[model samples]
Target: MEVPDLRSLRAADTPVVGGKAAGLGELTAIGLPVPPGVVLPARFLNGNDERALADLLPGLVRERGVRPPFAVRSSALCEDGEHASFAGQFHSELEVDEAGLAGAVVRCARSADAKNVQHYADALGVAPGLSGQHSVSVIVQEQVAADLSGVLFTADPLTGDPDTYVLEVVPGPGSALVGGTTEPLALRLGSDGVVVTTRPDWCDESFEARVLGLCLRLRELGRSVTEHRGSPQDIEFCTTADDTVVPVQARPITSLPALSARSFDLTFTPVCHATSDELGALARLDKVRLRLVAESCGLRVGRAWIIRAQASGSPRQEEPTALPPGLSDAPQISFVLQDPARLGGSIVRRFSAVGSRSHDLRETVQLVGASHDRFALIATEIHDAELSGVARRFGDHVVAEVGFGAFVPKGVVATSQYVCTTDGTIEHTEPVRQERAFLIEQGMPRAVTIGRTPTLTPEQCRMVCQAVEVANQYHTRPSVEFGVERDGSLFLIDFVEDGADDAGPRPEDLGIISSGRLAGRVVRVDDDRALELASLDSHFHTDRPGAAPAAVHDPVIVVAALPYLSLESFIRERDATSLGFVFRNCSYLSHLSIVLRELGVPALVDRQAYDRLRADDHVLLDTADRTVAQVPEAESTP
Candidate 1:
């Protein structure tokens, strides 16, 4: 096979013998540093016995009298097309010995028939026969130890900025350099001295200068190719430690678009968690809005508006109300609030409408009003007799509950009132003081006197002491509740009781025996002579079974579960059921309930009762209501 010199094959020869082989042949003829590499000419692809080419490569390497490993690569004529540049479409093998060079060459040639190459050709709209007719030319070059190697762009591929050429150099193997995994030293070069903006720690100033010089030479080569092909060209070149800079490949840079002088300033605050399509829609709408604003003002837009919003406040409250009518849900309101003087007459009018009291009208009005902080009128439900009482309470105070259409000046404030009747049911309140007292008076030894009834048995006292001991031992921080004996010992109660003891008193056989103050607070002992404290809510004498003795103080324990707690496990646990027993003992009818529905169990809360119970701690009993559970005292700390 006769090897053609680089100067003999111009741009036309590249169409015939492929760009890579043509470029190398041209480099050799121009006396470039490219190693002596022979190409397996394009015509060798005809016969089914193409393996014969591989058989010929070994003898050629032997003819060169060098046993060094050779690099076998593919050169396809149609690969670096102006419309479709196939960068990695063909196979290239490295580190092949002289004995192995022939087989590597044939394998590289056969890779033209690989599935990836076929798919790539198909994607370019090239017919199968057209693709099959293209042959691969194998370039066998002597491998060099590359200290610095990378690709150089004649034009800035990123911004298409023509003023400077971008050169990326990696100080390693060329393969790793091209793949972009390693950070390379990047330089922007023009007529001025090389701009060494990004110098890798592995590369020195001398290496950078050499790479810059090589890039300028390659740019000249690309200009020649562009002159011959009538279009800009992309050249791939590499340099080694021995100062060998070889242009391995060249292609037309097809991605260049016409440069535009017209510029736009886009401003947008992206909504959190917005999908790609939603964001696109928002961008389009913003562009339209900006255009409309600009057209109305008859001035080029210098700045665009951007609105940013964040969700705030307690999770229990509803999200901020939606934007009002005549405005999209995403409100883009423009106002001159920067100066107080320019605000009044500067307001621009858009769409406005009036409404009557129909349902649709009411809804539309509400939707519009919700977007503003204050509305013109207000309505509230108040106790009928307390109307005068409330007005008197807020005398001269700047508060109001005015009717619809009642207008007030922008800065003027006023107070208004309305009243209604209430049914004669007393709302239960929290036992705050009692719970506080129980928490304060815990763990002190004090005297106990039994009522006219019999004193509690020793076993019963021991059970109570055991309960208090468990509370004292385990509760370094606040606990739900603690069990205590009259003698000041701690005890723990079993949530699940198998059988009641005949010798010891039942949990309900307990009552307040006597009471006294300790640590600036009051304490009491039960009838079974167990130490107990009262809740801050009104108490109740329930006919419910297993109820504890009536006492001056009833302390309820409150426990809240985290969101991840399994509701099934919570319900199945014995401790959860025992909470009812503790609630009955407390006698206070208001309980604090925290719902962890997200954890699976949807907890029902009595908001009114819970709010009431959270406020106070006095144990005042009333036996009428059974639905409300009592509140507990704050847990005691040792």
Candidate 2:
């Protein structure tokens, strides 16, 4: 079968020509300079029929009439999506002569069904049945000996700003930029002009303006594509020896934000009707007013409840008023405080529970919060009542309502988040790419470790992809929390409501967690109870389950507030219970984290997860996929 000339194709031929060839075809049609090329459609491999391929080889060269120095690249039908770029996960054969051309084409076809490519496809939620060996097309282009080549992002990938354009230029073929070996001239193009952020000292100032103009044109090209697709594009270009700006490849920018935190049209009506900023402000104002306002917002306030007794030297006795609406339904603690004059100084304070089972969890949390300085707001006076001694009770009521009794299989799992889009696109983080260099060099390892550590396996990548696909099945721009299991299983645990802060907890940033991925139930171990559990020897009672108890059978992840117990106790208890993970509001460099890592239990010091956790909430800690999720009930039991 004769290879199809790129000039004979258009964007409509992507199914036959593949993404790269189709894009080049479109570029050539738009009067953009593109190296001449042909595409061997994905159907070439007919079940190891080598003799048929050998017969078709001579016809390809005869049709193209190009002899040597060809570029053979994999152009899978499923790649280069509006929401994903399989970047750096496939093979590209550069500078292949006639003898090597056929082999390169075969390799490119082989790479299409490679394990890594499958992982990438899985992570992006691509259909597996569509990406087999027969589904990967091969692109053969005349090698452009570029004097200069680079990549241009039409808009900032991070922060999703449309006005900002990012350009990275290197002196050789774009491969050098992709390889990450040579530092490039990094330029930021705004409303003004080019500003060189990072450049090699050898670069002449005169080259800046020329490079700027080329970059501006590329940005315009990106804009044209974006106008058509309704989203920005990432374009790759090279300047030939003749100074022709040749467009090589283009794909949609996947890293752009799908939705902002400020704009949330939620399906689940919020019980706490306050934005994070507003909540911060209310914490500083009158305690009673804050409580009332929180109640009005539908938030079940979890702070102290103050009572006004007989005022000193007051003649008339006031009947003790009935307890607040929800406070009297459950167990609470009573104390006395030197009441402020506003509530008539010196009154009784009661720490009552609400009907919500979460109240018991809150009481223990208050004690832990008081010791650790993690709790920001405190209840002082409610209405016209004065406060007294304040303390909370903790014990049986605070234990987990349900138990999780399974362990993650021993394999690497990755987490990835996605946001749905109005244009039917599901966007994720920036693609992982590297430019090529004719000659490659290996770099020294930054840090060396002793033993084999947990990492992302082939199964994990597919799992991540599965999660993204599941998330896309729901609402537009859904906040998906998903991860892979050690056994290569995929779990799309949570589809959180919008308005979750982007600045929230990140497990990888914390230094304590040594394991790359983990899964368990979130159990809050109160400060006092944590200390007690830590003090116990290996014979610690297995019968009485601690609030955040370590279990021998089920993997239990302990979440503790700051200013927690000693390292020895933690290590002992973790060993006794076969604890799977630990997270605390400790510093990344704190002794606690350092010791936990040394003990070989994966731990992290991200307080954001700690503060938001509830008793019995199942959570999965996946560092590879950069996701942490509350495992949904449907999958939690086993």
Candidate 3:
């Protein structure tokens, strides 16, 4: 029941006075210029005591000769958190006199139950309640009689770049700006300089200079508030007729981008770029799956490492962080393949003018077969999706569109290919700009021109080279595919190994297995012969003396008679990265096909397909088509 002065409270008083009053209190406590205010604590707001609310007027009027005209605003206890901003959702009454202060406070308290507030809260999946009751505190403050008002975001709200500060200023008080009624001057200030993105016709040279000066002065003030709050802030501020800037409110930037430790940085160097000679040195550590080889040599599978979620009886996590697999991502270590493959590449851009609009981000995600209500926002506003998997492609460059990488091979966008050097430097062809992007209408992806200008930036081009350098700077000479995010962050989508070096046979000469599921080196295991532990006839094996295989070794496709009950244990052992099988005939459950299917390993039935394959010869297998084809030796790296 403590109805205290706003200056007497701090940010920790949120549960009592709510987020708005607590923010003002924090600013006031630290000697930052804030409009004087007093808070009617949440518990007192619910007390239904008309007499106790009477102190609000005297407090508003006693603010160092401040006058009768005031602002009464709702400050819900959960108003501003990291996840939801709740901006403009509640009520605010400006220019209220002493006679109307009582009514304004009542309206402010009742705004918590308003339809817009309820709907906005429900969308973010958190109720602003304490102990089963939706709690709200009322803030009666000395309204600033200002020459100009605006909002300042300490960081770039769109891209989450901490180095940028965005200031949006209107000619008068901020109500018109926040209510979406007026066009404001939008200035983006970074360490480099100031850039005005939006300037109204009336904003001339001197007016623009004053606004820019105010923005520069607020830099340290904004930084101080952010440091004190332990996060970037979205602040409401006004410039007085005397040219002094005063902060009116502060709140944590909801939807601030929080990237994890596996952050894909542009300056990152790969684990190792194993040229052909280095690949031979790695023969002692043979793991035939290209994904495994890439990782062993310090190559990332995609732009960033992807982890899978597990189903269980434990508590659910808000984000994915474990290494359990199913169909969504890769279930086991796998290889890439392309028919008639070339040493060319393509830049797979998903979002058009990313960081420009929310719909563009939605459309970008829709192309990748991902959709959610969270992605819905205004055409020009882009918000962060705290944790996300932007784009993933499992297609071996067969078809050019798919939702997610399915059991079948497919891509997410239409793109033209470019040729690159062994070190992943773009050489012959200039990358094409995607003419159109796809948006999800109903349940299907439809081509649209809404998000265009989706070309790669120079920074994005450099990131692609870096991503590809680590992934394919090896003997494979793989055709690399990359995804450029909406914020211009680049990710290496996949690498398609044609299994051909410059001196080897063209990929098509190796024969066709319809399309491929994954690739592995051939090691024909007949029904009677026990598998050898030694590396053999292929470059993948070292023949290192005294080397013994363990429960977790490299993968090899066994070509022999149908799987029997005795071979089940050997096939199921964890010793191999992931074992595959090739039999002469096919059946669903009669042979070991059921187990192989359950384990998500490659299995096929075709006798003639083995004619072109031999021990240690690399091959791509299509389990559904029941065939396998030899792949030529991979090329050398940089």
Residue 517 error, candidate 2, Å: 75
lDDT of 1 by residue, 14-124 (tens): 656677777565443323455666666556544425466556656766675434677778887766777777678788887888667667767777777888878987887
How far does residue 312 in candidate 1 sit from its true spot (Å)?
59
> How many times do residue backbones clash in model 2?
18
Model 3 C-alpha lDDT per residue in residues 213-318, reported as the tens digit of each score:
8765677677666755657899888889987788888998887775322211111111133344433322222122334445565433331111111222322222
Model 3, position 78: C-alpha lDDT score: 70
Candidate number achieving the greatest lDDT relative to the actual structure: 3
Residue 212 accuracy (lDDT) in model 2: 72
Which residue segments of model 1 deviate by more than 4 Å? 1-8, 48-51, 62-67, 129-134, 196-230, 259-638
Per-candidate local distance difference test: 0.38, 0.48, 0.50
Candidate 3 accuracy as lDDT: 0.50
Instruction: Name the top TM-score candidate.
Output: 3
**lDDT by residue for model 2 (180-274), tens:** 88788888887677788987886777667678767656666665545333356788888877666777887778868742212111111111344
> How many pairs of residues in model 3 come into backbone collision?
2
Ranked by TM-score, top first: 3, 2, 1
Where model 3 places Cα greater than 4 Å from the true spot, the runs are 48-56, 59-66, 128-133, 259-638
RMSD of 3: 27.2
